[model samples]
Target: MADVQSLLDKGSNNGGCQFIGIWGMGGLGKTTFAKALFNKLRFTYEGSCFLTNVREKSKKHGLDALRKELVWSLLGDKESHIGNAIYPYTMSRLGRKKVFVVLDDVNDHEQIENLVGRHEFGSGSKILITTRDRQVFAGIKVVDIYVLEALNPNESFDLLSIKAFKNDYDDMKIRKLANELTQYADGNPLALKVLGSFLNGKNQEAWKSQLDKLQKLPCREVNDILRLSFEGLDEEEKNIVLHVACFFNYYYDAEDVKKLLDACGYSTEIGLTRLEDKALLDIDGGKICMHSLIKQMGKQIVREESLKYPTWCNIFWIFKKSSEILKKNMGSIEGMIMNLSEVEETRVIIKAFRSMPNLKFLRVYGNLNVQLRNKLNASGMMFLSRNLMLLDWVGCPLKTLPTTFKVENLVEINMRYSKLTKLWDGEQNLVNLSKINLSGSEDLIELPNFSKAIHLAEVDLICCRKLQNVHPSILSLHSLHCLLLIDCKALTSLTSNTHLKSLGKLSLAGCSGLSEFSVTSEKQLFLWVCDATINGELCSSSGHLSKINLVRLQRCEGVTSLHKLVDMRTLGSLDADYCNKLASNLCSKFDEMRALHFLRLTNCSELYEVPDNISLLASLRQLDLSGSNIETLPLSIKHLSSLRSLTLNGCKRLLSLPQLPPSISLLHVNDCLSLETLHLPLMTEDREGDEFSPEKFSLINCMKLDGQSIKAVEASVLLAINNNKAIYFWAKWNIREKELQSGSCIGLHSLS
Candidate 1:
């Protein structure tokens, strides 16, 4: 416990309602920090009747109630029904008072925007938010953010000692026991309390045995607590929470969430606000993070509710279900079966499958047995004999697409990954089939009569190790947008037509023995990983190149200069990952390639020096010169406004990283075992431009450099790199995304 005097000392010594956001994972006591801060703020907030437990009641309270409750409490009114109350009543009062609104357990952004978003309160009227979601506080004005880290081993022992050892830390025996117990808890306060409570009355041996069992305890306990948190939610709020926990999970994209919710019949923000107020669900970072435990509990509740009603989750003799929850045209499925074989495989037996006879987007997909067993067989082709487009059965061990299945309506087809040993359908006039994927089916010998797929957008034969030929009629697919023949080792060349402006992603990597690859596309994400030279004649300078990766194409003899690398503006990442031919300062013209963020010329022996102003491209973040002959960086490297990581692991020619930007906190010169000298300056503060002396940069693992410690780095220009990994990551590093729960089934919330 910090001295209360120190808490007071850190307070009001500043101005305005200090917007403090306390963040942590679900059980790390973020709400506890907010409570502690509230205890300190109570004297200042005389009108404080802290709605102690607002989170668990979110669904029951709804948004209107949430706004009215906070407003009413501040005004000392008890009646909860808001309609009887007058308009602008809470607004006018909050406008005058320096209120402290601590919306604890906020899970959604919309919830916060609904609760306190309308208030035009004065400056000191702080809105202290505590949430598991840290990114939710982005864009909102949070003056000070306190991330609630897990308790340390000592702190954890202290907390447990109070509960188990009767606050006796001086007792040597109890102290040792407390340390052992702390190890089992992994620094979680909640777990420590539970273990301490359960093991208190037991003797030392029982405690040790329990500790062993507790060490094996997983996240189940944490989830149980979360489940209990939602069990406290009101019924209406419960419905809303379950609705979101299931169907609207992936649709957390604001517009998508709203659209799906509207489709499910809740057309207004009322349902969302209703769920928000009870503290059952809060929004953060524009996504809904229904506590993992709460989501599981919600599912349990849904299954129970469905069972009780005996309709929604149909459990008649076979547990069949009908759902409209999946996206209409996507390859999405709903309903879980105990066993696939036991489940109804025939469309006629299932209500959901049988009702939709006019399925528009049918694609062919099945194994070799499904194709060979049905090629001449009459009954096996009945299911796909009508309106079908986009036939993609690439990896489906298919001998060939059946000739008996005369397509009544067909468009795109993908047979790329299928193992087709032979294929032919001499039928004519079935000209509706388009795009085909015969990519990895190396055993395939012939094509299904190609004139039918005249409108085909693209055809991919990538990794079809034994791919033989492409028919001339297939080449006439003028609308083909993406053509991929990557790694077709036995494949030779493309058909005669060279103009394919609609192509977007063309990969012909690893065609070892092949002599040529000739294709003209406007914008293509091409990966030429082959060892042979691509049609050198077709490598002319023109059109847009969104992305180009040339990995291990060592036999490419013609492409010596990169000046012919066209369309720099749209180029996203140029992966010269192992291009030994590339030398530093090779391509100097495209200085404004803002989209180029990752440049890897690792293991390129010919590279000596990078071009001047190469670091001017502010978007570059990761530059790996891991195994290059780079000697010195351009002076303009200091201008790399957005660079975060610089790797010089194998840069034998490189000696120093002086003049590196202060914004750079990570320098992976880990394996640069070469001659070096380093200078270090201790950075007194974290804000940029605080003070950058010539000695602010230092070295790590630089044994060849003048080995200097932080003790000796006192008076250098480069700031002594904080030896603390905690401050290094917590202080300045920013991650774009975190592991999140982005999976939510839509069918669970869809109504009958």
Candidate 2:
């Protein structure tokens, strides 16, 4: 506590704006110490606010909502600003007021920029940030930093005694037990507290028995405490933790795990939260994390089962014993993860899988160096269990799956880098299948019929270089949400008439051989950003696409027009940043999408002009026309009442811009070397439309601005900078006759 206070004083005692950072590993009491410091010093500042769960809340909601909550908490008001205006509003409201703020569990630097902006508050203000990853503060300016440490042996024992044996502290036997338990805890307070509570009411005999059981288990005290957390969990939660501990600890995403566990009839979200509460698991940076000790405990439990039945263990990690285990007909195995490269049983019996009747998950991966005849074969077991849910096999040598293999209950199949030309001989009734990945299967030529896969949500066939055709039945999936066929060079077309109403994302990038995108889904699909050869036409004219929020196309050749959007009304954003062949007048169709808020047409080298009536999109808030061939803004652009940000970077041909909109707050015009004129409207301090002025302005490398235009807009730039709006000016200009006479060229060119 004294160290923490001293660190805070090093930043706050000088009455200068300061930022302090606290970083350490998990279970090190970072949050506990920060909260204590917050309570101690919060009253000294004029206003204070502590933002909790910054990482989790930012994911569930966006940063904009968090910004609003911060503003409301600081100003004690009913309503504040919204959207891009929040930054300026926060800077204005907190500039002269001394403040104390603590942002807890922050994981991104952008969150800090959005919430705090800068340390420009009153002289006495101080901001504290706490996080588990020290790299979260890499680019931020912090005056002081502290790394919290774990407790010592005596400190650990005392903390445990208070929680476990509060009323009977003098008993000699219990004291000895406490000493022994602290050795296991190793200065971790969470483990000490949890273990102490578990032993609170037990008798000396019970304690002795528990200690004896621990001795039999090879794990030391920390693993035993983690095992206690596992013991408190229900059966479903236990399965979830064990699966994460064994296979999906840091590789698979949380959402993917949820999908797999959900297929296994477990309430995954609730179970994960319960495990986190018990300190057995943590979700950090959107990935699952578990301590090494906790994970070892889970593996130990499975090995104990191996001790009981060495041949039919529920988990198999020994590859040399495969032949003996299979020949003995051990059938209790539920999970198997094997690497074929290290196996010494080369000519094992072909009936191994048949003995394991309860297998649910199987993953086999490794480089098999043996010849075809020397490999351990499985021809005798023609059929797999119907209860199997996940099958991930790499470098499979068979030309097709076994003829009698049952796949009715399978939920996921990943055969990446396999040698199979086809999954099966024909379509099977795969009703429960949700995900299928066959990437890098160069010999795969076609897909099986998916009409019966009603639950299918995602399909990935990326880089299947030899894939030539897709089964038309895949187009009819009603529950499909994502479909990826990137780099399937030989694939030519999709079903022209089908309804994929639930599909939201479709990717066909690098499908150079494909010349058509003829699917016709309903109007319910919302977002589509894909690279497909459309033969110089946009979406199918006959199909009705709903109001999509975003559509991005890159490097798609022979795409000349978007006339298909003439009837759509709810298009929100359109991006064709590098479509070099696109040379049409897109503004002619812009009027049809009145709800469009963002439009990006950067680097479209052939785009020589924009329509004069482009300002018809009253809802446009951001317009990016960088790296294009346009020479000047359309006169009608002044009518964009809601436009707030206009980025025209690298517009080499642009010579001038019309009067910017009154709602504009950001203008980026860097690298416009041909620009010579810029027009600025007078700004006032009123709430009406005429009082609006940009808070952020950049003019780096705009070399050709005339001296007269620079003189004309210099006052507005100075006014905005004086108001603390952060205006920057960089212009290449020759000395005017009057300026040369006064010798003021150096002072007039640069503004900081």
> Against the true structure, what is each candidate's TM-score?
0.46, 0.66
**Model 2 residue 131 CA deviation in Å:** 19
User: Which tens-of-lDDT digit does each residue in 230-339 have in candidate 1?
Assistant: 56545544555665664344325444345434533454366555455434455667666554334555655555554454333321112224233211321221221121
- lDDT, candidate 2, equals 0.69
Give me the candidate number with maximum TM-score: 2
Query: Which window of ten consecutive residues has the lowest lDDT sum in model 1?
Result: 724-733
